[model samples]
Target: MRIGIRPARVVALLVLVIVIPLSVTSVAGRFMGDRVYLLNSTPCRVVVMEQHDGHEANPGETVLIKSGFVDRTPTMMVFSGSAFWFGGLHFTTDTLQVRDQADIAIPPSWLSSSIMGKELTYELTADGQLLVKGPTMQPSMPQPKGLPLKARATPDSKQCRRG
Candidate 1:
């Protein structure tokens, strides 16, 4: 005798198969993505040679994060996902400078470990150790600077990275 397959049962099974994994993935991503922040303390804008996976943003280029006017509302670059999470992103540390001020040189070790400060999604793992999560949306602010970065040759006398 052939077994009768109920439509409702098939739908339920399909929902369980699709919805469960999606919900789990979403929840895991929300808690597993480390937050990367770059707070610009100076009055002048801070420019970073940023490397991001999205070609629409910058690809592997520079971005100018507007300077913070007041301490209460500081301008910052809050990047997550492979952009700031992955420590091996070499193209990112290529440049860090303040307009009409000074350039900051990043050490190889720092670059390898990622200069951007991170808030662990889970305390148990290293920053960017798990990238099951990536940035879901691009915010209105922090758009990549349209103009190309100007060359700076002055002594990299300023320290830009701070905890």
Candidate 2:
């Protein structure tokens, strides 16, 4: 015995098989493509150092300061982030004069002049905890006489772990 289907039925089945899977695959691809992920979870290093007197920081400026580790490499610091959401580490010093231009400007500086060239290093973890080594002070190159301070965060700093 032999069975045969009409040409019209065969064409309908072919269309259904091709069109349905294509539509489903396209939808799934779009859903997955919308998301972004950073593979390596290593923490980013951060440092907050003393700013020159009369320096004004704007809304979005990133600064590099020395690291507390023995290597004393330069690290990035921002006014706002996991560690310094309200304000990061604070220090005070007599040799160096620093100012806080934020809403609350303290006459005495939180970061000391001693840390002028030194880098106060911290590790920003994925969980929002800032891990900092003991504050280390180093002599830093002299900053130009006049420069306005600014608050800025790096690309990695801006991303928080997805819940």
Candidate 3:
């Protein structure tokens, strides 16, 4: 007769009961939000080139942070932008103005981690190129001084997806 259960069996059971559920829960959490943090490792100025969707203010602009990234320079930067999703990376996102910028414009996120609070660092070459630890996406620095204004509505949707 078995005392209770073998140690190996117990371990396996624990993994199935606890570890597996935890893993599944974590993975599923990604859908909770599309937040992200972008860091710049470039020497030159980084700038947002394009953004596709999720703008509540301007339908024409596509995103509010396109012109928001703070001096995406090589020296060092992090997104500080905010959005309906991602944090305006400690660096920037779309609108480097207002309160910096962030987004559902999902970026290359960290492992086992939800897209939320994901820190995606990038590097820029001397000639204006891009680099990163994994898949890359973010804004550049020194975006015009103030936020670009449009007559339609206003600089809304720091939450952007420049995809």
Quote each prediction's TM-score.
Answer: 0.25, 0.20, 0.25
For model 2, how does the per-residue alpha-carbon lDDT over 106-157 read when each residue is reduced to its tens digit? 2222232332232222233334333332223534432222212222333254
Ranking by lDDT: 2, 3, 1
Worst 10 residues of 3 by lDDT: 60-69
TM-score ranking, best first: 3, 1, 2
Instruction: Candidate 1: list runs displaced more than 4 Å.
Output: 1-5, 33-163
Taken over the whole model, the C-alpha lDDT of each candidate is 0.29, 0.32, 0.32
Prediction 3 TM-score vs. true? 0.25
Q: What lDDT is reached at residue 161 by model 1?
A: 24
lDDT of residue 163 for candidate 3: 39
Candidate 3 residue runs with Cα over 4 Å from true position: 1-5, 30-32, 39-41, 44-163
Q: Per-residue lDDT tens digits of candidate 1, residues 1-163?
A: 2345677778899889999888876555333332322332222223333343221122222222221111111222222321332122212232333334344333332221224322211010122121111123422222123212322221121322232
Give stretches of model 2 more than 4 Å off: 1-63, 66-84, 91-120, 133-163
Q: Write the per-residue lDDT of candidate 3 for residues 29-89, one digit (tens) a residue.
A: 4333322232333222233422332222222221222111223312221221321122223
